[model samples]
Target: MGELVDFFVRSRNFILFVLLEVLCFYFIINTSNYWGATYFNTSNRYAAQVLAWSNAANQYANLRQVNADLALENQRLNARLTQLLQSKPAAPAEYQADSAFADRFKFVVAKVVNNTTQFANNYITIDKGTDDGIRPGMGVISPTGVVGKVKICNRRFSVITSILHSEYLVSSQLVKAREIGTAKWDGVDPHLIKLNDISLTKPVSKGDSVVTSDRNSTFPPGILVGRVRTIGVQPNRVFHDLTLDLATNFSSLSFVYVVENRLQAEQDQLEKQVETEK
Candidate 1:
């Protein structure tokens, strides 16, 4: 205490000078309207800038949650669109729709609990399962496009075979030329998939749209798969090899729709009967 008193005594002149300077400034601002206005204006500008910087930092920290919410909202919009489009009737009776399939597709919105793209046979796990009406062989899609097929399901969780996996396959069709083929990933680029068995006669070009074919019992027809970004005609190969830019960006995927085809069992039984006759 004695040392503190001695130090204060030693620096008393400097402290007194600082106090007097502060009092002089306060008196000038208080007595003069122009000075007070200028001081307040400067303080307000600095405060606003500080507040803006603080808000920006807060927004940056909340970006992940915002993105997840946006994904979920997009998924809901897609579901509503699907319902509206599917509820409409066809234009004619003689349409003979080979691509138009009949499947009671139910969308179960679930967040991705697990995902892997670095392996040969990549898979994704969701926070839904058999207890939630999820089952094996159920088709899964996102708001952007097709994701994969459900391969396994437990009580509250399910594993999906991602399109990036080697074993993943979907019955796909070229929307522009109506060329149906099998869509599979080459396990190279995450965004690219191979559309094989499409005939060379079909006039396919860059940016040609691709969609799911009704020929498959898994996914319903017209579900967007991707767009054809490149087409290559190989030597000695009968069909054109096409590259598709996947509609769904798997890296940012959070929510997915587990499409349950209600008529799947009935269709399987009918196919079994046909095979028995054969």
Candidate 2:
């Protein structure tokens, strides 16, 4: 307290000068119309800038929560879309009166904890597992397109065999031609994938859209795989050599949805029964 008082005494003259200067400016602004307008305008501009900076900071802080919310919303929309597509009738007579649209697929939103794309066989780890209803063989998809299939799962985490993996294969078809093919990574490019078994005679061309086939139990039908980038013919081969620009950018993958087909067990069991009889 004594030191503070001494310091104040020493700076009293300077403090007085500052106070007089502030009072003179305040009087000048208030008494002169032009000065008053200019002062207020300058103050308002500074205040607006401060408010904008504050708002931007707040938005940045809320980004994680906003992203989580969007992921959840996307899960709901994806589930709904799958259900609707499965319920669509092929023809008036083919539509069954007893066939009701059931939500067979459930979506679990998860954040990618780790991902790799440069290796021959890439994989992704997500912050969800058995506890979150994520299980092995479940299809994983990003907001933009198909991602991979779940390979392993623990109570709190799961790993996915990414589509970029050479061992990974997805049943896919051309949207325009309806020609079936097998989508596989060439173990060379992260942005490109190969689609095999599509015959050269099929009405396929560059820029044609490729998508998941309904025959695959792992992924729902029509989920985007990629766009046909190039088509080539190998001499004496029956099938066309094709490359696609994969829809999902694996390097930037942050969030994904694990798709659970509720009827998969029943379907597998029935198919097994047929196999046993045969």
Best lDDT goes to which candidate?
Answer: 2
> Which pairs of residues clash in candidate 2, taking residues 3 or more apart in a chain or in different chains?
none
Using TM-score as the measure, the top candidate is 2
List the candidate 1 regions with Cα displacement exceeding 4 Å. 1-15, 89-103
What is the per-residue lDDT of model 2 for residues 48-145, given as tens digits with 9 covering 90 to 100? Answer: 99999999999999999999999999999998888777877344866652233356778899999999988999999999999988889999999989
Q: What local lDDT score does residue 182 receive in model 2, on the 0 to 100 scale?
A: 96
Instruction: Name the 10 consecutive residues with the lowest summed lDDT in model 2.
Output: 93-102
Q: Estimate each model's TM-score.
A: 0.83, 0.93
In the range 196-232, model 1's lDDT, one tens digit per residue, is 9988888999998899886886775788999988879
lDDT scores in order: 0.84, 0.91
